[model samples]
Target: MKHLDINQIKEIIPHRHPFLLVDFIEDYEPGEYAVGYKCVTYREDFFRGHFPQEPVMPGVLTVEALAQVGAVAILSMEENQGKTAYFGAINNCKFKGKIVPGDKVRLETRIIKRKGPMGVGRAEASVDGKIVVSAELTFMVGQAGKND
Candidate 1:
């Protein structure tokens, strides 16, 4: 298992700051799969209003985190360097448990298929080895800085 710090991850994917959900990537094979983690904290801006009482991690954001992992796997490819993978579709998603502060969420995304500029990835987020979210994500690679 290889490891990539946030700096290395940033070189592969464009996401940054609060939007860069994956804190560290443990292992990833370009155009194949990515394994990463996010350390949830109460100090997060989302917790301030996502719920003052419950503070559950937003489901959509969890999926976005997975997509970011997929982006790393796809963008890390030598030929695809500096490209941006945009969400084309999200299918068959499921949420089984709540994610709150103090949880270290495990994120995994595997590219199941790819044809030209489009591809599909199987993504999931788990905590304590229990899957809390899963989805089949579709994406389209576009040139960096493209408006579309």
Candidate 2:
């Protein structure tokens, strides 16, 4: 089992605080798959405006979190080192449930196909074993530039 802490995850992906969604990667296989977690808290900036009265994690952000998990799987490959994976497209995306603060989202993304610098990942986000979101994400790998 390959476990990755936040720092290790940062080494593989370029996301940062407030945007870096995955809190801990439970395990991963380079170019294969990654399972991670995101501990949602009330202090999150988005909750402030997303719904002060009744906070809810935005669906888009959840998808991004799932994407980040996929990024870890893709970017961890030796050939992809120091590279960035950008979303080429998001297909079959479905929001099945809402994510709330205090929920620990379990994220998983499996690389289903790859060709050259492009690939597709089957992603899912769950809380307490209940699927909240699922999508097929297409990615395009490219050189990581400072502007990325």
List pairs with backbone clashes in candidate 1.
none
Cα error, candidate 1, residue 110 (Å): 0.7
TM-score of 1: 0.97
Off by over 4 Å in 2: 146-148
Writing each residue's lDDT as its tens digit, candidate 2 over 1-148 gives 9999999999999999989999999999999999999999999999999899999999999999999999999999999999999999999999999999999999999999999999999999999999999999999999877443
lDDT of each candidate versus the true structure? 0.95, 0.96
Misplaced by over 4 Å in model 1 are none
TM-score of each: 0.97, 0.97
Residue 135 of model 2, lDDT score = 98
Per-residue accuracy of model 1 over 42-120 as CA lDDT, tens digit each = 9888999899988999999999999999999999999899889999999999999989999999999999999998999
